[model samples]
Structure formats: C-alpha cells, structure tokens
Target: MRNPAFGHRADRTLPRYFYVLRNRDGEARLPVYWEPRPASRDPLVREVYRVRVAGRTLEAGNLHVLGDRLRDALGSLLATGQPPRFWLVNGACASPVYREGEAYVALTDGPRLWGKDLAELVGRYAHYLASCNGGRRAPVSVALFSPADLDVHWPELVWTGPGVWIPVFGVDGRLTAFGPRDRTWSVPAGPGAVLELWERVGNDLVACGLLQHPAALWGSEVSDSTRGALLASSEPTGLTLRFVHFHPSGAGRVTLPIRRLEGRVFASCGELSCLHVAPDPGTLREYLSAHLAQAGVVAGLQDVVLEEDGGASLHRLVRAERLPVGLASSHA
Candidate 1:
C-alpha cells in the first residue's frame, strides 16, 4: 500500500524547513518541509508552493502567502499543541478541499464567506499591505455602509450614522478613513491591530459624546460645570460636543464657551474663543490620545463655531481634511 501522507513525486533536490515550537517543556520541535515545483502549467502563475503539515498539504501561488498561511497554522498548533480539525487561513471558507488541487488541504474550520466577513478581511489586508509599502502616501477610499450594516457586521466598531466618517491617522500626521461598511475593500498586507485600535477610539469618542450624529441637528452642548463633572466621573455622561481648529503650524486651539479655557486665555480673541489650553486640553484630546503612539491621532485642539438654525452652536468637530476625497461633500 502506498503511504497516504506522502505524495508520489519526482524531486530533484529541495530545501527543507524547521522552526522551534516553543513550549514550557521545550521537548518537541516539529520539522516542516515542501518542494517547490519548477514552474506552473498555467502561464500566469509563476510557480506552485506546497506545504504539508498535520497530514494535509496546502498550496498557494506565492511563497509569502503560503508562508503566512503556514505561520497561522503553526501558531494554532503552538497554542493548543494538538492537531486542529482543519487549518485556518484568511480569504477562504469551509470546504472538503481548498481551491482546485489534489492536495487534501481541508479548510473546514474557517470563517464562512459571508459578504460582511469578506469585506472586513479584505479591508484589514489592504490596510496592512499598503502600510508596509514604504512611506508613500495614497488617497483613501471608503464605502459608505448603513447603520444596520454596521451593527450586524462590526459590532466592535461604532458608526454615528451616514455622512459621519471615522478618521484614521497615520504616523506622518495624515488622516484616513476606515469603518464598518458594505462591499469588500482591497487593503494591502496588514492594517491588523492598528486599524482595530482606531475603531475602538472612534467608539470611545461616540460614547463620551465627542462624536454625535449629524442628524441630531441640535448639538449636545453642556455647561462648563457639567462638563467638569462628567470628566471627573468614572463614567462620563457628557453629550457636549466640542470643536477645534488646526493651524498651519500644527497647533490646535479649541473654542470654549467660558472666558478662560483650562485657565489659559489666548491673546487673539473673538466670539469663537480659540484658546490654547495648556497642561490639559480637555476630554476630546484625552480620548484621542488614550492609546498613545498606537492611536496615530494628532494632539491639537482648536475650537470652532458651527452655524446651525440661524444661530451659532458649539458642536464636536472632525476635520473634513481627514475624510476620503469626495466623501466630505456628503456631510454638506
């Protein structure tokens, strides 16, 4: 009888691979090896990469993609130290066999190819890959999804409603947008953990009343004493939205109803008091910087007056500069 684990093959010489599966005991380190075919039958496909593990062989078009897949499989084995029922890989669904191959690579324990799940995975991958390609900046494009879609698809992230795009920041102080949305977003390599942090910050802003629904029309303005009380409390119930202006010099000044903002009054004075609050900038800035360097948000807080109902109303501000091109107009 032929060995079920080994495929009938003619291998000239191929490289083998191994990695230490770290454990408390440090007794076992499984060696993994695969032979790359010289070339693929299909002209477009450069080559075929195969990886055999746990009695299953998997193949992918590119070496890096296969490497990532193997890394994920090894990670799972290390966590439980037991052979999983099926190997898990992104962009795939549960099926008897993965892709069109004789290799019995069963992928029966991965996320279903639901529209929502696929979009999220695509967005994450796109973000990750784009960020990895050096420091070149690119325009951001975000698909608008309804509130219902957000609730169903991304319960962890918050959406304040249509036309209100969440801002994602980068190390260069540039802004981008990513949130719960319909359709797939083709993001590169690994937005991964950073994107998730951005979403959590957005949700916190909404919860703290810094991000309000545009349709609310009436701003959730609060008194100075009330704002102070809210900030002091462990669970702040402040619905008081605030605004800021960003100067060319990268300094942020906030509009405050009170004469002195955080005890520092600015020399330049107007109806819209753009005061540079020292030491402490207030709740919005505090929330934005909650994750420190990982958050990627800038630390400037200038206030602005919003015209509403033929009167000036103070509302929380998110810069249109940060939103994806052509999306800012929707808020108008």
Candidate 2:
C-alpha cells in the first residue's frame, strides 16, 4: 500500500515523493533535498533521497516521523527552487507503494486529515510553507477548513461581525477594519438585548463577553451596583449576553458595564449605592493571550484592564451568579 503520509503512484508515475533523514547522533533534523520531477510514465521512486552518516546510509525506522522530515526537507528545497504558492498537511501515517509506468505519486488515507484539530494543523503547515516560499511581500494566499464546511473559519469569527464595522488585528499584529464604517452596532429590541463585536490581536478574538438587554441598561432602577451584585451572586437572575469585536492592532475591544452595590446606614433607612465598573484589563489581556496561543501566536498580556472610575464610592462584594458557571461551561 502507498504511504498515506507521503503519497502513492499511479500508471508508473511518481506524482510526489518524500524521504526522512537522521543525523549521526540520531537526532531528527530538517534539511533540503532535491530530485528530478518524475516523467509521466515511470514507476514511483521509493527512495527519493538517502541520509549519509559518516559515509554510511541511514535507515528509516518510524515512518510517521520520517514523513515529517521528508516534508520539511522538500519544503526547504522548494524554497530554493520554484516555491509552491501554498502547501498543506493531512497529519496521517501510511506506507508507500509504487505504480507501473507512472512518474507521479498520490497520497492515501486522505480521510485522516478531516476534523477541526487536524484541519488546524494543516493550516499551520500551510503557514510554514508560505513563509518558506517567499518573504512577506509575496504572501501565499491560503485558507484553512475542517472536513465539514459547517466549521467556522477560526479567523473569520474574530475579523467579521453582523452589522457593525469593527477593527481587527492581523496575524502579524496589525489592526484592520471589518465591514464598512456606516454600519451601526445595533442591539436587539427586547427586555434584555445587546449587540456585540470583536477585535483580533495576534490570533485572539476579543469582544464583550455579555451585554444585558434594554431592561438591564446602565443606571435607572436596576442600578449597575444591583446588577453587579446579582451577577456575582450564586443565583444571577438577570439575562446576560456576550459581544466580541476585532481591533485594528490585532487586539480586541470588549465593552461591558461592571455593576456592584454598596450599602450605608442612614438615620432613617440604609441607602444603596450602585457602582458600575468596566471590564478588567488584566483579565482581557489574559484571555487574548490564551486565544492566540491556539493559533500558534504566543503573546503576553501587556495591558488587560482599563479602569474608568465613574466617580462613585462603593464597597466590593462578590455576588452569587451563574456567570462563572457559564464561562466555565463555554470554555469546556
């Protein structure tokens, strides 16, 4: 059977071939390899290239690792020669086979490349290939997708929104806009409705976690303090929604009112003060870092919390709400 990791041959043509090379110390290393593109009517070349160890040849042991090495080597060679526009990997393992009179090889077990995790890996490989193909000036246009079309493109979630034009940061940490500027961030008309957008910084998608409905607007009888207490409490009665939008600097902008209540004893009856605080910058920064890490973009939170004191004095008390549970469940 042809190696699913590499490819097989048909009609005696080796369409594609890959080989692995190990150093004398038995450490796997990535290097360059070259071979003549096979003619259309030749059996596939099983041994594309050999690794030399002090004038001796090395043997292939682990086929999977070998395939990875071969891929890396081929990538390096392609960089020096006519680089490919883009490259992708399915992340599977299989043996190699040759065909009669075929110069090209085809990969088997292509189904292994199917799922969300595998698709992401394939995307990463494509990104690596693009980098090797050329400099940033000649960017390789590539798209990543899972086996099913229903799977949302990861970046798309962070870059685009419903009706609002928000800014989004690119993979390179530059900010860009999503949609046209004339669009308004509209909130649904209901007891508790809100609209949300997100900004992307690095690989992260940042947006407001939740926006209460019109009935839960800031101030009024349902004061921010009361809402905060309710949310923090074990039993949160208010309806909450999350909104996310991308920023131009690859960072996301999240806006939500922080509500908490404090009480003071008066000569007649105790008075209640409502306090509304903004999202914590530190928490936002941490969230962004975590999100980007999955995309192979590692970033530290430079600033997470941005505090704007509404000039209200209030005491801090944790409320018993299901919000924490909701967050945990969503992450899970």
Candidate 3:
C-alpha cells in the first residue's frame, strides 16, 4: 500500500520514495536517496551535507547538536576506520519534501549504511541545521524537480501566512489567489502551473506536518471564553448588542453597536465602518457574515466578541437582549 504520508498525492513525480520510520532499536534509519538538483555541484561544497552516512539519533534534544550528529551520520567511514578529510557521500540521500513552512522526508528501518540514502538525509539536515534561533526563520531556495531526470525550475518562495508557497506552475493548482506580484522571480505563467503549484504545496504540507487548520469558529477558545458571557448578558442588555471585530493583525479592534431602529438593524463600524441596515436578524446575519469572513481573511482577526475585552489570548463582549438576533454560530 502507498504510504499514508503521501495521502492522495501518492503519485507525485519523484523517482524514488521512502518513509522516515524508526526501527526496533528506535534509531532513525533512512533510505539512501540521491538525485541532485542544479543548486549544489561541487563535491567539497556537498560536504556541508554527509551524502554517505545513514545512522542518526533522532532524540537529540539540542537542535544544534542534532546537526553535528547528522553530519557524522552522512559522512563516510574510511577503510582505515577513520573519518575522512574531504568527504565520502555525494548523492541525494537527504532532500526535503516541503510541507507548510517546514520540510520533512520519509524514514525507513534496518541498515543506515547505504550511499543513496545519503542524499535525502544530507539535504534535509542542512535546512534544520541552518535554523534553531527560536522564532527567527531563515528562508530557503526552492528548485523544482520533474520525475528523476533533474531539470531545474527556480521559483520564488512565497513566504506568506503560516507556510511557504512556490508557484512552480503558475495559476492556482490547488491554491487560489497566489498570483506572484513579481513574475520574474517565479516560473513563467502557464495554464497548468497554477493548479500544479497549489496541489504540490497542499499535499506536501500534510505530509511534512506543517500546515494547520484552526478549529471551527464556535469551537475556538475565544468563542468558548465569550460563550458563557454572551448568554449571561442577554437578559440585562435588552435587545441592543455591542460587538467588537478583533483585527487579525493584533493592530486594534473595530467595535460595532447594533440595535433595531423601526424594524431595521442599524449599526456603524467606527469612523471607517459601514452603516448596515437589514430587514431582520436573518438579513443582518447575511451582512455580518460577509463582513466577518472578510475580517477573518483580510484583517487576520482573532475573534468576534461581545464587548468586554482582555485575555492572555482572547476576550469577551457583545450585546443582544444581549445578542444580534440569529446567534447561529456561537454555540452547540
């Protein structure tokens, strides 16, 4: 059976594939995979990666020390039983499968004494070694590969949101609205590139454990915090509701006080906010829904709350009698 790691993308164009699984000894064993991209050419330059050795200790607590162990694992043990002066491994034993913003490769069991697996291990470890400075993330260059022949397609890595986007193929592939502003930095626009780029990014994200989808809005922590408060204030506030649209940027919030005036919902959003008048709560829900979606997407919002504000990560507020009528999304 295809590795579940690949999920729906088991048919990607890689020439060879292996999973990063642990053996009975619990040591990290790797499959020797090598097919160098056009980036690294010199054998000495490749020493930064140990394209030869395969035995690695996965439980190294320190990421820096882990880099050292990786170098040793990929380096060659000479016939005289000595670590080499120049290097020994020189293939794609360690290349990354980029997922979300991070990279990961398949693990294997048994012998770590293969030359081919060196490529996969060396390339992946090099990336992990370059980073470890807490939250400061270093960027990486993306070179696209086709099948096993190793043709190079250089694309600008779109380091946005929680992950990276490489438009190896132009258009939306699986990702929508990823039109690179500067075309020169990305591959030429193509009919197939859009979907291809998005599909690859999406698939690899799941495989490498980098992509994250938040809980449904009501199921969110912010919602939980505000839920009880929302119900508690209902009888006290009458029908007037005060809501704060928490900006996603942590920049600030937009507070909107909504009330019914002559059977029409009238609400204002600060100085820049809009005046939304709807016939009923259902119609008002439609207006609020559109604006909320935009707020969540554009402003990078934290939450839509009932009025009271303050939290380590969230807050509370909102008024209805104390709700805005159709409170469909806030509870069970």
Candidate 1: tens digits of C-alpha lDDT, residues 1-332: 11234444634233233333443434333334454555657764555556554434656676677768877865654353433222222233212212122121232233322222222433443444345457443332222212111100112222222223332222112222343342111222132322233334345445656555211111011224322322232121222223433334343333232112322211111222111111122433333222111223222222222222232223332222343333322112
Name model 1 segments beyond 4 Å from true: 1-140, 144-250, 256-332
Backbone clash numbers for all candidates listed: 20, 65, 45
Candidate 2 structure, TM-score to reference: 0.19
**How well does candidate 2 score on lDDT at residue 150?**
10
- Candidate 1 local Cα displacement, residue 86, angstroms: 28
**In angstroms, how far off is 203's CA in candidate 1?**
10
Q: All predictions: root-mean-square deviation over Cα?
A: 21.1, 22.4, 21.2
Local distance difference test, candidate 2: 0.27
Could you tell me the C-alpha RMSD of candidate 2 in Å? 22.4
Error (Å) of candidate 1 at residue 27 is 63
Task: For model 1, state the Cα shift of residue 32 in Å.
Answer: 60
Cα TM-score per model:
0.20, 0.19, 0.20
- Model 3 clash count equals 45
